[model samples]
Target: MRYLPLTDSDRGDMLATIGVSDIDDLFVDVPAEARLSGPIEGLPTHASEMAVEKHMRRLSKKNLAAADAAFFCGAGAYRHHVPATVDHIIQRGEFLTAYTPYQPEIAQGTLQMLFEFQSQVAKLYGCAVANASMYDGSTACWEAVAMAGRVTKKKRVVLSGALHPHYAEVVKTMAKFTEDEIAGGLPSMQGSPDDAGLIERIDENTSCVVVQYPDILGRISDLTEIADAAHKKGALLIVVNTEPVALGAIKAPGEMGADIVVGEGQSIGVGLQFGGPYLGLFAVRDPKHVRQMPGRLCGETVDAEGKRGFVLTLSTREQHIRREKATSNICTNSGLCALAFSVHMTLLGEKGLRTLAAENHRLACLAADKLDAIPGVRVLNDAFFNEFTVVLERDARELVRDLAEDDILAGVSLGRLFPHEEALSGGLLVAVTETASEEDIDALCSAISENMA
Candidate 1:
């Protein structure tokens, strides 16, 4: 029999105590049109654990995972070799089951890991500080915009059209409730924006100008000039990156004078996992804006014995204490993923990450060169990190589908994301991670060459 914790009489009594005549009265705020009339189609009421597991396993076997194909698909999420050690360590009972440490004295280990993660993020981005972790790259972008607005006390934000379409949509969704102005400039598959046009949209009311690093099209940009322009108008420059691996080869956003830097840390340790459970890396310049930043931050401090200890520091912005007045309503962080990121980064260290990044660039350049040699295909950018776009003679979506049928996970189609842009409909955004080899690149090149011919 199904468990019903509260009986009908109990519910009615509770409703009457609250001055509601019936249980339906509690849902008065919900509109009738929006309410579901019946159970969802094709959904079972319940199932045995063993039966459910078997069904789920059968369903999961149908996916074309990176390991099953010659993978090259990276728009934001990437497939890279994750050390078995990372999984082993993160799965440890102490680290795996640990929740947010409310009591600082008892949760030193968790707090220290978070502290280290924050320090590593700050160093990588060349920013003053970093919070623990946020939902993912897209939500972190939204938080960065909100923080910029809080810090600058302004309402308008300008976004580069070269920004990832998903990231832009997240920012736009948040702006709707905040009643802030959002300006999205011209879209380009090259990933570099028409900075001059974006600059023209900035005004006194603008709080921040947001752009991506090695943006959606895989073009790296020097934001120093854009930062200067934003500062001239008393606005901040927020730089977003979907590929943190590029930081090892390209200049850090902070070096380019970006006021805030946010990116996905998935490439470092986290697997693609279809979509996520990925880590969002957020960092900012040292100033009073720390209080305005969202998420938890662990700071180094002293214990009763005067030895160094770590604790959840500067948490006034979270949900538990600040309530409605909090800077952000984001309560929990991506703890396990952040731990995985920290562990993998610790294993790679500085020089290893740089070498890995260089290898990625080398492979991507080789792929681009080989593909460009094909008839009816053209490489669009001279400057890129690990990814680049190619102009194709046919629809990129159809080409990708054809490539997939051959057991090759091809690149993303620009047209799939921006349907209205006729020019981008035939462009493909190809990515190459360290996991890709010479053989893989050749296979992709050969497939495209044969298809085009």
Candidate 2:
């Protein structure tokens, strides 16, 4: 009752003020079948706090955690070894409880950390400027699309077939409200990315060409050519990096001529907590486009005392600006997660990050070679960073489920990612990070062999 403070009369009054007949009228845009008519079938309608906690703990145990298995699951979110120090630093009272730095004076500490984080992201992306952070990789992706549309003044978006399906979906979902035309199809089951295909699709009306580096299937492509092609057509190149660690070993998208570089920062400091609160890294290759970028921007400044200080250099979010004029409507950022990422990045300096990247690729190659040797599996990528695709003789979705039941956390299945596409039914994506040991790889290979047998 305390939480549900609004009375029926109050709700009626509020609804009338909004000129809606009923609460249901507010969700008119949602399809009828998608709306729930009653309580969830298996979940209890209400329960005591202790009872709920106990039930949740029991349910949570059913989840095979990444650390508990010969983990290989990565399709955007990665399970990197987050140093205990990262968690320790972020858990400090000041960093953990700090909210958005609305007032720059008292929130200098928060602003400073964000400024450092932005610097790390910009350097990592090879971008001229980067925002503080965004909701996640997916939303940052959509924001990049929206920003491209604003900068290029076009409606058509050419997405790479190799772009993460989830990221593409986010762009498409947001495009519905803006009426932006999305053009792309499922990725071809090939060794390389469809660079030529994506380039061919770019036209005068194209606002941006979105491509994921070391794309969904873990195949790396040179973004320079695509960037040049998009620029020739007056379209911007928005490169999405789902795995930031790869940048340590490969070229940054911005360095490759991408106009905007955005990605998930989960691999750095943030661990895969099932799915999210992941960090979103957003940046622009040119400082001129900074105003058009979404989320907050922390800038270095000198206070009245001539002391170095960090301030909210630019806050273009809807909360800080007029709704129609704001670059994005994102209310707040993944502040804590960003801090974690920053801490992790700081711990893994330039040399350390490169070493980590190398280790990831080393393990991935080992796993790929081992898996390819299996009777019914074949590695798909000729060049991959730390993740690769394998085509199996059997449906990968079934294999994954079977392996999962045995407490072996197999990789993501293309069948699960693209449920309706039968062409991808037998493709499995296996990710290998530094956390995965030689024995873990052996265990994974052995399990797959047994299951496929």
User: Which stretches of candidate 2 lie above 4 Å from their native place?
Assistant: 1-56, 316-318
Q: lDDT per residue, candidate 1, 1-453, as tens digits?
A: 144588778888888899979666778788988766677878877777788899999999898778878888888998889899999999998989877888878888899999999989999998999999998999999999999989899999999998899999999999999998898854755535567777887899999999988888888767888999999999999999998888889999998999999999998889999788988889997656788899999988999999898888787777888899888999888999999999999998999889989999999999999999999999987689999999999888889999999888779999877777887888898999988878888899889988875
lDDT of 2 by residue, 1-453 (tens): 445799999999999999999888998888989988777798757667788799999999987777788899889988889899999998999878777787878899898898899999999999899988998999999999999999999999999988899999998998999999999799999999878988999999999999998899999978889899999999999999999999989988888999999999888888888778888899999999988888888899998999998888666445556577787778788999999999999999999999999999999999999999999999999899999999999999999999888778899999989887989999999999998999999999999999897
Evaluate model 1: give its lDDT: 0.88
Best by lDDT: 2
Which whole-number lDDT from 0 to 100 does residue 351 have in model 1? Answer: 93
The global C-alpha lDDT for each of the candidates, from Candidate 1 onward, is 0.88, 0.90
Q: Lowest summed lDDT over 10 consecutive residues: which window, candidate 2? A: 313-322
After TM-score superposition, what is the CA distance of residue 253 in candidate 1 from its true location, in Å? Answer: 0.3
TM-score of each model, paired residue for residue: 0.89, 0.88
By summed lDDT, the worst window of 10 consecutive residues in model 1 runs over 185-194
In candidate 1, position 371 carries an lDDT of 92
Best by TM-score: 1
